[model samples]
Target: MSQKPSKSTAPEAENAAATRGTRLFLGLSCFLAGAAMMIIEICAYRLLAPFFGNSVYTWTALIGVILIAFSAGGYLGGHLADRKMALDLLGWLLSGSAVLTFFIPALHTVFAAGLSAQGLIAGPVIISLLLFAVPGILLGAVSPAAVRFYSLTLKDTHVGAAAGTISMLGSLGSFVGTFLSGFFLLSTFGVRSIFFGTAALLLVLAVAAFLLAKNTLRQQAPVILSGLFAFFMSWMTAPKPKPGVIFEHESFYHHIEVSERTDGDVTRRVLQLDSTMEGGMDAKTGDLILPYQQYWKLALLREPAKVGSALFIGAGAFGMPENVSREFPEAAVDVVEIDPQVIEVGRKFFKLDEHPRVKAHAGDARRYLLQSGGKKWDMIFGDAYNGIRQIPPHLATQEFYQQIADHLEPKGVFIMNIIAAITGPKAELTSGMLATVRKVFPHVEVFAVGYRRDETQNVILMASREDLKPLIQDRYVQQGSWQESLIKTHVPKGTVPHASYVFTDDHNPVDAIIARGLLE
Candidate 1:
């Protein structure tokens, strides 16, 4: 206290304090950036879902393209950081990303209409690349640049450790982002809100960047004006028009829409989003009508009492639930669908509101089943996928099927739809899936819908604990009111060929399966 501190010692101490603060700040920023990137990926899926029905091909293409884009951004960001580690550049980059984030919702309507005209392959591929590439590249640039800037500000001691700490935080943030997008953001905010929320977070990031660059900030006027312009332009624009009756709403997790032919005095309402037509309902009478009606007819082979309670995964258009409720009026029906907007659409467009016997739970089918506390069912229907893309991997897992097996009653039936290339070599996929089910269920059956026995394209799989051979015997002679009135009038054929292959979580190459069918 008596001796005044040396000038050299005082400056070093101050530098150490400043360095510690900057490192903490950089760690926080990196965390935010990682989360933002993941959110972008999740939202991209939501964006693509309407045009493509969550098919294996669609999921593969989307994810593969995103990974490629991220790789490209990594290269580009590293190059940019080498040239300049300025905090000003970092702020602008975040600001630019925010601008793009804000515009995505507005752009999606236009992009979808364009896809409809040009086709998803020719249109969506190009559109997604153009719209998303730059922002992705800019985002990729953030982590490297942040580390570089931190290196400049920090005292030379433990520079590598500090950079590593920031990197660790970023990775942790990414993990958090993946879960948050699915479990929290999508399920709570709806699609539009997620986009807007992402923009707000980016705005906060930009502000932080600006503060860090206070001493280095160049002409702030232009940056402020540019940001204002981007936001205004994005907010002022309206959604693009479509020819069909487009009904859009945010159901916590997804942007659900139902579009139909308005001019025709048709009784059917097409319940669709992206490419998956959840189901259809009679526009006039609100009666449930969908391809699933044919699937339900498979139950005709089972003992009537054995089919008492039913659990339907993916309660789209609520057609199956409504039909099941009508058939087994006393049955306790449990319907699990992830999208809340889909449920709302079911109520408004599909008369789900009037159906008192069915209870709809808005959550992922797998998580719900695992956590459903030993609730068993006589018939568990897994109608979880559609379109040329968008199939969720978790639902198609070996574990999920095992859970289905554990939850099913002794004489229960488990059915799921697999879009096969009904033609050529693709038939093996249907065969493979049948084989997979037979691995556990003892008996497996197939019903080729929208195609002839001779025609190969899309097929439905019906598996059972007991032999379907007995049901095959009664299929022709046995008569129920629904069987005689409904299925016999439509399918006419009492039985279809069963495929010999089984699909497991590890080996199910459904995309290649569809591609073989399509190419063949």
Candidate 2:
């Protein structure tokens, strides 16, 4: 109390101000670091989808691997930050993650295709580890590093305040990042462009961190140069487009592609959703080219004596609707497809035209059926699927089959295209689907496309209110005449293994059933 403390000199005061400024930048880095982590996580699924499918298994593997990376990074990062300058560590981490993210667009296919060759069960796990682990670890380290740096800048050392503020900033950034990626970034800019943007943001943060570490602009120039160089190299390494692919896109739903291939006299244009061949037609005949679709011709032959109107769910390539419009020129046909881009692709490459009789609606098939008030069709077809292995669960339940039945005329028919095994280890999906459909429509029949009961193949299931067993007795219908050859593929109801359960909306395990089927 005898003497007052001396006031700080101008340089010391200026330095104190600089430290406060650096602390603010440190908080900004934490926010961005959180944003970067989420962006990478969301986009990572799209990276794997074109190959491994957007299955629940793929989702589980990615989430698990990323959490593991974050945990390890947090532990190691705290140790490093205690021993070294956190701002310096954060700078290095941001730079490293930036470089790795830069390379993702060019190199993801190589990793995905390689490990996916290992088969479905273990492939996604191994590939996710290889492709996502390091970037996640590096980005994960940023939080603790920033935490320590912020603590060092304070005089009283309020550890709880430092952590809470940093965590809140990161959490807020996470909320922003999730909405940004899901709502805007992916749908607008696409996945690869988002990755490029994320990389650039990280590079900027890296530079800011170094500059705040008392580094000269000259000292940080090389990092700027290296980031530039890496992007250029990565751009050069991007894979070339595949042959026969006329158009391609990353829709919110699937990686859709259209390609043309000729076999002998037939030139076929095919619409592929992910790895599944959902639609195709002959170039000249404009007729359906794939065999499964050929099964749809039974629509006109079997149930309705005359077709005036038809409703087709899941307009793959618009093949069936186009077929119906051509079959009965006066018939009004409505095709419902979930992906508008797929509908766009149908128009662009699949010859989906402006026919007055054919109307294409972009929306979910189930909702469309629910909204229909007293509208009935002579024939209703369900040609939708999630992939080769499974149908969309909501589309396969007893309630959905009831909707199909309710929307049909008294003599109308419902046809479903199913890819499943008949009587072997992988037969659960087929048994469950058949059992569920039979509950709503008493007359049920099936035709395995390849006529092999034990193998997984396209099984065309037919249901109607009218008795269909009589068709087998009709000579012309079964005479190997018009649709008689299709009769040869008939799967008698007794041959189908009885399932212990039926699929309902609340209890549907269609995806899980397929996953287990794949393992077997």
Candidate 3:
């Protein structure tokens, strides 16, 4: 019908398809490289987290250091490419990445413990910096080299288009890297596995580059050989956790550790969730005590007759769940935590397995809430974060509170704990939190659990549609629970009046608030 499409056009179309396919492949390779680099960067923090608290400063420093290294590498890569543009260089660079990745575990172990074992934290940092410098430099060089190689092959304007596309692909890979590592690998496979997984991806890229560059590009045997040799040496030095050690890892998410505890006749093991020591219990006795006893008081505050079901967002060691089960035998308790290793540790060492009434879901709290499908709760606990950062951004937002509100029954109470130090205008952080809750809940009541006169106090905020005055009066601090007993008597009364500030997703500056609190 179309005057018989020219036969020559068929071959042209096929050639176009082939070219698109090749470009697609190249883009994918670059994407994977980007992902692998990011994976290494994120996992490195997890490796260090057990030793260094996963502080905001630690994360910032790690990112800043890597970015600086990357910038230098990019400059060097571009200069080398301009001097001599060759696919072989790309292959060599990729091979180097693979070698560095494969050796990361060994290097990390040596850097973390080998030097620190001698009581020298500074020595470990120096060794780590040295070990990381080369790999970080090489990884940083990848993008610029890739851009140069692709740009040299393209026409004037195509160079700009290709560069933009490649950069976008790299960003996409970064997004995937963070999500996959956080939701899956870091939670299930542990930090070491994440390194190996990323390294394997780089190894595949290296092989692909080598094959494509052979014969078409100059010889790069020496670089490849050096990489292989380094990988082999590091493989030999890889550290292994000692046998009978139930669990051991470092991660940004949490300082992870679990060891089998055998004391007297009790053959069972105990789990320690963090260095901060939030969750732990007797493996055999399943006896929750002290600090845990304070957490258990929350369950008792619930209307005894009405508390039919409860949701514990961060059941670190399942101590709270165990206590809930013991006190409310008929209540259905659901625990949703991000880390499965934590649950495993709980079962192996924290007596989590002994509690038959509790059901555990291993996933992020948000994912759990969304998937649970309109299930109403009697009480929702917002004890998911440590005082280190007030609350996780996702959890502190107005939308999150709305979700919490959705999950609660008509008379249901939502309890949250926040650490704040000032009662004056400096109490903006507390005000912000109250303001966030006030957006949804009409009334917010904060009962100072510890000494109200102290500059720093742990205050329990209960938000509900119904009044909680009776509950706060009879069952809270005045009732003299184990929680109230720990409070210092000298609570500070601020001369300045409290300010009313709100924390919505759009305006909550928790980091700034935290900084101000520290300053005060």
Candidate 4:
């Protein structure tokens, strides 16, 4: 028989079990920190979106700040870990991150709005740094602290195994976080709620860390309870909607709000997405209040002999589609609004009525045009502006314009609402759009809705197969009512110079161009 195997003593076995427990707890803490870090990074976009827009600049700033924080944290965390071997180091790092995470939602509006007013480019960077950097650093500190703690608890001196195992767990947690947040958390919950959830998860891990350090429950109760209280208070104290904000929601694509504004004789309900006032309706009468809604009637003025059907890319509560339904009783008006919630708001608050001719679909405008299977419309309205300076990239491409042209009847007209400076160094946006649209349509006419030529404001671009020069000229010279006067005065006699570079699906920078124009 082999030499009699000696059974391990109770103390030795207990020590082994305790080591396993410590390692497991440290691993769990790291995994959670990794998940929380990703959740915070992803949701940071939504927080900044309402003020700065979800632009490339916003993303660039978030990613850059987060990475730098991680680098600094890793360096500092390694130093702290070398100096101390206590499990509470990882706990405190997570605890600090949790506190900062709770502070985010309360501070986002104040930081984003105040910073954005200063400079668009710098605003995103500064806000990202102010809001996310400390939390990121604290979270990032978890990895090195965890690895060191894990190494200390290991019975075998395989340092690489300990580090690799911890890193793998953290990475696995990151994968789960990316999938979970993108597929579910964002769509299923609001931004602040997501923030609070993340904070709670982190605080729990901090408690676990303390417990794993062999600290009695009594020792950590005060600290853990304080965090719970902070989380609760933050949730309770979140800002309420402003005075006239009757409806506010965080849609998948936008931070949408329907608010009322009154000025002496005028009162209106405005649909706001992020920082842009998409459209408005009179508070009492529910008539269209945006000047563009009225200006877009230039299509009706040209009045395709028979408009059997029409498509409006983005229908807000302007009552334009309803107007089209009534104005042209024979026309079948289809409204494609991307956000379904916006449609609900229109129905609930803005008095969108049901008409047999006016049907609404909640989906992408481009996909609608593509899947229409050569179905033609007499009039196509392009009023889909998704951001302050960011128009959906797919919509601004040459391919999309061609699709619009292809889906129109021979006498069909396409009217697009563009916000750009009509004349000045900042006119590149209008020039680029003209160049791109001209590629698909032989004739295009532009009317300035904004009185100031150099001011960045609404400019209507109209395109069709048949030239409406005589009709345009007729409207230009003759004036009677305010509507006619608007047509007569704003239509430029000469066309803008087309940009040398065209916008194709593969390569388009409309968002950057617009932002640059706005800034410069």
Number of the predicted model whose lDDT against the real structure is largest:
2
Which residue segments of model 4 deviate by more than 4 Å? 1-7, 216-222, 225-237, 261-267, 283-285, 303-306, 474-478, 481-483, 493-498
lDDT by residue (282-313, candidate 3, tens digit) is 66666653242354354355455446788988
Each candidate: what lDDT? 0.69, 0.82, 0.66, 0.81
lDDT of 4 by residue, 1-520 (tens): 6886557677788999998888888788778888888889888888888777767777888999999998889888999999988988887888888888987887774566678775557788899889999999988889988888888777448789988998999888888787888878887899999999899889888888887777888888876777777677677767678888988888777888889989766688888887788888777766677777876576666654456788999976747777777677878888999988888878877667655678888999889877779899888989888544678878888999999999898888999988887788678888899889989998888888777787778878889988767666754544576557556545563556558988998999887886787687
Models 1 onward score TM values of 0.76, 0.92, 0.68, 0.92
Candidate 2 per-residue lDDT, tens place, 1-520, comes to 5976567677788989988897788789889888988988888887877777767777788888989998888887788897886466778889988988888877775677777656555777887788778888888788887778788778538877888888888888887888888877776776778888999999999988887777788878878887888788778876677799888788777778889989888889988887788888886677887778876666666644468889999988888788878879999899999988898887777777755688889899989988878899988888987555446788999999999999998888898888888888877878889999999999888888876688788888999998887865454554545477677788877888889888998998887887777777
Q: Model 3: runs farther than 4 Å from truth?
A: 1-32, 48-72, 85-88, 95-137, 143-188, 196-245, 249-255, 260-276, 290-293, 298-306, 366-375, 387-390, 402-412, 419-459, 463-500, 515-520
- Residue 213, candidate 4: Cα error in Å is 0.7
lDDT of model number 4: 0.81
Residue pairs with backbone atoms closer than 3 Å in model 3 (clashes): 46-250, 46-251, 261-269, 269-349, 453-491, 453-492, 454-491, 454-492
Tens digit of per-residue lDDT, candidate 1, span 1-520: 4998687998889878866776677777788878988887776777776664455544555666667777787776667877976677777778888778777767775666566444434445665676677677777777777777677775446669757876788899899988999778776776766877787788777877777667434555555566666666766765554556568765544556676653365566786665556677777765655554557657756767335788999876777778788878888888999877677777777778787989999888988988998889888888876544435656765667888999998888887876664434545565556556667777766666664554544466777778776665456643665545433323222233355444566766655554444445
